[model samples]
Target: MANFTLKVTRLGFCLLQSLSPRIAGKVAFRLFCVTPSSKPKGEKAKRAHAAGVAKLADAERFRLRLSGGGLAHAYRLNGGALGRRGRYLVTHGWGSSSAYMADLATTLAATGAEVIAVDFPGHGCAAGRALHMGMAVKAIAAAEARFGAFDAAIGHSFGGAALIVAAAGLLPGVPAVLPQKLVLIGSPSEMHWLFKGFGKLIGLGWPAQQVFENEVRRVTGRRVEEFDASRTAGAIQRPVLIVHAEDDKEVSADHARRYAAAGDEVRLHWANGFGHRRIVAAQPVLDTITSFLGEVISDKDAEIIPLFDLPARRMSL
Candidate 1:
């Protein structure tokens, strides 16, 4: 039924494109920006959600008002009288909440580093139902204001693009701080690819596609292609670790190559078999990220010590 409904919707968009390209593009653009709800429904799901929250009950929960006027939810871990090595800011991808990133954030906190995982606009516990890269940048700036400068920022998928854009400090009035290092897991390198792909998915014609692109430019004050992470790689000039699986069905591994090619310090880790979502929580990937961030686990911290071997090797693009 869902597949059939999607096909009918695509057909409707195609007809609308024929009648009025501008209107069709506007509607499609709005649909494209809408994020799926992360709130759990039903008794079993709610119970699972509660369990996940309880796992991080020790975290210091907080919120920040973003420039977009929405409350950005975030939580701080390992912040109470612990010897800190560094501070890390973490962000989740589209259709996901900070709960999904709790594993990585908790592990980082276990290393005695202060870790704060942010729920971006329209995601997790944050307010709103729509999100764009611009809004995401504001969320990062808001978190930085509340938490101060971070030693590193880690993002998965959509979150990765937000981190790179915020680090670039290209957007006006955002005043985002660039982190010392970055880790991008299963992230896209270009907004152009995502926009064009969405257009094709909804059966938008050339005229409709142009209108959609114009809407993006008007909202962001830049072309969709300009949102490329590879371009930001040159501007930030910071150490970057790109963990991508070759078998990823969502964002292609080529996106990882784009960043590696553009930056001298970018290292690409081919974490095969984990696909897109699981790659974010895989033990090997987590270990590689910790090593990149200069984290050294002591004998006393058995919980933070990694059990998986680091998987780092060169792959032919």
Candidate 2:
């Protein structure tokens, strides 16, 4: 680990260790779901502003009422014909909102198909304080109902895991949330690993880990131990794009490797310098995503676009 990360981890453990396990769990959970109120300063703010402009350009902002409770905010960036290329869905990861995904959605909208970006429950305009795996699934289902069927879906980080979960039908009443073309940017491949990491960070130990696993099992009705991205990816018979930044400290590129195989069914792209969050804003990364989406919208009936056909993206050192 980097010295800074190690120091932060140590400090976090020291502070959480002073609390009871229950209180520690609560603190950890709160930390996990809370969204930041401020926009990044300097260059980050500039990039974010550019992204927001993309969202506002010929965009129709709307809201959907989720079955679980509150309203889910969305922006539909106008594309070509109403459903010519099929509706495209773009979603941000945990603790993020549709605004963060606006640039990609805007770029994809250039293909002449409406690109809809959503704010999941507990994030953005959606109501909630804590987000469970089940809630993400519900958010997707609600989006599908409100925005129409998605021919292509792009999810960042936790949003990617939620797509797979929705696809697996791990939860009841949700159909296989399949999109003809799917992209996962900086997404983790295993749920158990995330749970264990959270528990370890909060000094919850094995006891807390077990409680988390039990909660996941209770919600999804599946073995938490078997929660692997490869397993879920195997179940979906569609084109998938997986992008992982080599320097990402939050989620390693190895997670992307696990989801990638030796076929056109799944393609993996490596990015650098962008870290976990900025990868979504990098020019090369943006080109890579647009190249993939362009192909999907290029065709009629929304057939699978071969990954090999995409133009090369020059990675920086």
lDDT of each: 0.82, 0.71
Worst 10 residues of 1 by lDDT: 308-317
lDDT of 1 by residue, 96-196 (tens): 87887877888887766789899987877888898888888888999999878787899999999899989988677788678878999999998888888
Candidate 2 lDDT:
0.71
Clashes of each: 0, 2
* Candidate 1: residue 290 lDDT (0-100): 84
- Model 2 regions lying over 4 Å from their true place: 1-54, 79-83, 262-264, 296-317
Query: What stretches of model 1 exceed 4 Å from their correct place?
Result: 40-51, 80-85, 295-317
Residue-level lDDT tens digits of model 2 in 1-317:
46787678657755664555444555555564455543444797667756665566567767777664656677777643453344788888876777777767767777566778877766765666667667777778877887677877888999888887776677766666777678889998888787777666555655444554566666556766766876678667777889888899988888888888624588898987888888886789989987876654333434444432322211110
The prediction achieving the highest lDDT against the true structure is 1
Q: What TM-score, computed on C-alpha atoms, does each candidate reach?
A: 0.87, 0.78
Clashing pairs in 2: 80-112, 80-113
Error of 2 at 187 (Å): 0.8
Give the Å error, residue 148, model 2. 1.8
